[model samples]
Target: MKPVSLYNDIASTSYPGRGIVIGKSADGSKAVIAYFIMGRSENSRNRVFAETEDGIKTQAFDPSKLVDPSLIIYSPVRVLGNKTIVTNGDQTDTVYDLMNEGQTFEQSLTTREFEPDGPNYTPRISGIVECENGNMNYAMSILKSADGNPDCCERYTFTYDKPINGLGRFIHTYMSDGNPLPSFEGEPTLVEIGNDDIDTFAEKIWNSLNEDNKVSLFVRYIDIASNKAESRIINKNK
Candidate 1:
């Protein structure tokens, strides 16, 4: 395997769009997970992360200003037994349901594709971190349009068993800001996960995002041995 570039500062990039990061913390004791959303439109920006019984969901910061809830609002994270599922779209539920039926993560995502929103045709990115037998492993998937063609869908899945400490993989909806947003290309980028402090890490990520476009962020660090988790949430709207 080629040496992966370590992205330590996310703010270096103006826009990475919705992203997911999964890896092990520097301490080598916790499984780290992070998901964040950024938007250029008012509809996408008017949102906040609300904690749910199992995970987190996006809600309109001002319900009255919400124009379309179809694609902007959905549960971004959920927990099913020893597995935690996160996604950039409603596929979170699809993966959850499939897992409940005893199906694998990749199999569940095979039935879904990129977002219907055209021109951009935003890619659907999803991940799952499973903790069991005193160990943790993760998988990430991205479903995108084939060369901007709405009719063709391209799917990619990456799995990591026993991820290296202080390292994570990041996959987002877009490669960068564009007139018609371009889909994220190639494999997920490798990133460094500093210390085990959830607050500092979460704040670093939130602050790194383009201030004007950033909306909300959620970070979780799960102890592999005890199955315990600590989380931090930051919402610009709040």
Candidate 2:
């Protein structure tokens, strides 16, 4: 599929819910990863991406204002060896734990499904980037309801081996805002991953997102040869 402009795709939607992007930098020197959260409710918006030892976790910007933590709070990004795992919910732990037990990324996700939120059944979008021997590969998955039917779950995993420079895949929880938010359909959108440093890349994504719905964003660039990473976090609350 032809790559579409990342900024335009994100700016076109008022609420994409949560999203994950994995790609290679234009210079082909760094492995790029981006994850962002957007919300329509108070509980969802009252969040900030806090840096953890391995990755980043969602925490309430205002502790007292947090109404429900069940679905709102989660470690969206985690690191395991040379692999980086990112997801929309607690499934991050599921992938991390299962993978620790020698399970593949796709295998680890088999034990989980879409969120329980009715009508919407928000899809659990996930991504993993692995780097070794100066080579990088990644995969993205979406565990969603079968056409909004809770009785069935549909899973899709897209793998990229030696990804092309300046290109990436974009996946999110919703297609757009609605009475009952619609789950994202089809494969992840092919997006342009321009040559930008961590800060510039983060700014581009943060600025493209809907101002009122976007909560927090995290962007990281990992050097394929050294396995070193540089990251940036942007939170609307602060």
Candidate 3:
């Protein structure tokens, strides 16, 4: 099936948060993809994705003023080999351990509760990386529901791209341009790693974030070259 584009999917909603992206870069060596989840509640305020030791981590910053730090911050998930990691907040570790035990995604996800937003606190978003013919096809979905809660049951496949080099670029444009969402204090950069060396890819993303964001980052790697994979979650704060 042809992958869906984030641009066309989110064009209808005027929500202040939420950025979607899907595309390839000029070199075509790596996929330039990304997506941002925003919220009207405290947790969704002034947040940014930072690179961590495990993977890309998320943190709540004070673009202008941080009313409360305890309520709206979270850890990051790392990307490793042949594994797709997805969760609401800090389920990275839980998901990783489960996968280690040969647990399915659905089984792992069922162990947690939706993020703590009364109305829209629990939107189940998942990211998957699949290996096919010496390449990885990536897809992520954020279950959008009218009721403001996580019902992985309902979803909108905003991004679906395979063997394309637009992963980061597509996400950059989608967040930076289309349906532009407010950014954190810094000019948060959307990054692309790997497509060359899995170790390098993992390292760059891991060392890219601040200590806070680095606290919890999930890692998944798809070794198309070997047709194998590995996934893990690092909870630095704990």
Candidate 4:
């Protein structure tokens, strides 16, 4: 059996609103992006990812108490295939639509609002495809939260060769949005197990996480030459 390693397992609960994990999948052909918008409020508790003509759309499943949701959970672009984009709140479809119409990356994000979690602006994480050749690049920004009333924000980007065999720099900031920016500092961890070991590893990781915090876990592999990729998302609550 091929030896597998731990990549990153960044766990965060800072936003009373949502949690997003974006990175490269093991075997590294496709990008891995998981978003879980959670809250005690009824609107926040509902899920919001749906397929759209251009790409994907997010709408309050309940649509009752959700306020200004358009700016809160939208992604202005989507990078799929060789490019894929995922955001927790909105703008997801907008991004997809623009990209489908041939808009440039930055062009797609031009009108979207910063994240709502500020000091980090609602935190937005993205996994951008670097080339038609299938390489991965990523970026995320957080605007200041309401507590700061404004005047605080943070932006970070990690774009490089894919590292599926080991760990890379994992963000460490907490849900509090404070400095000393928290991170999973140990050598990066990789999660590339053999097909045979996936079940066991999945069980271990799934059983170990808290019920509410446990979101979806996806793994993918690709043959660079063929440009074909295989992937899946393990939604524990499903």
Winner by TM-score? 2
List the pairs of residues colliding in candidate 2: none
Could you report the Cα RMSD, in angstroms, for every candidate shown? 1.5, 0.7, 9.5, 6.3
Residue pairs whose backbone atoms clash in candidate 1: none
Ranking by TM-score: 2, 1, 4, 3
Residue 105 shift from truth in candidate 2, angstroms? 0.7
Error of 4 at 125 (Å): 3.0
Best model per lDDT: 2
TM-score of the candidate numbered 4?
Answer: 0.56
Q: Model 1, residue 67: what's the lDDT?
A: 99
How do the predictions measure up, each by TM-score? 0.96, 0.99, 0.50, 0.56
The whole-model C-alpha lDDT of candidate 3 against the native structure comes to: 0.42
Clashes of 4: 45
lDDT string, candidate 3, 32-110, tens digits: 3333444444445456656665456666555466566543444435444555454344656666777678875546655
Candidate 1 regions exceeding 4 Å error are 1-9
Give residue 26's lDDT in candidate 2 (0 to 100). 92
In order, what lDDT does every prediction score? Answer: 0.89, 0.94, 0.42, 0.42
lDDT of 2 by residue, 48-162 (tens): 9999999999999999998889998999999999999999999999999999999999999999999999989999999999999999999999999988899999999999999
Q: Which scores better on TM-score, 2 or 4? A: 2
Model 4 stretches with alpha carbons more than 4 Å out: 1-17, 22-31, 48-77, 94-110, 115-121, 140-154, 162-164, 168-209, 213-238
Per-residue lDDT for 1-238 in model 4, tens only?
A: 2323322233323322343344454445444443443343344444355544324444555566666564544542344556656554455665567877898545565555445443434444443444355454555433223343445333334444654522222222234323422322222123343332334544544444345644333333333445454443345333
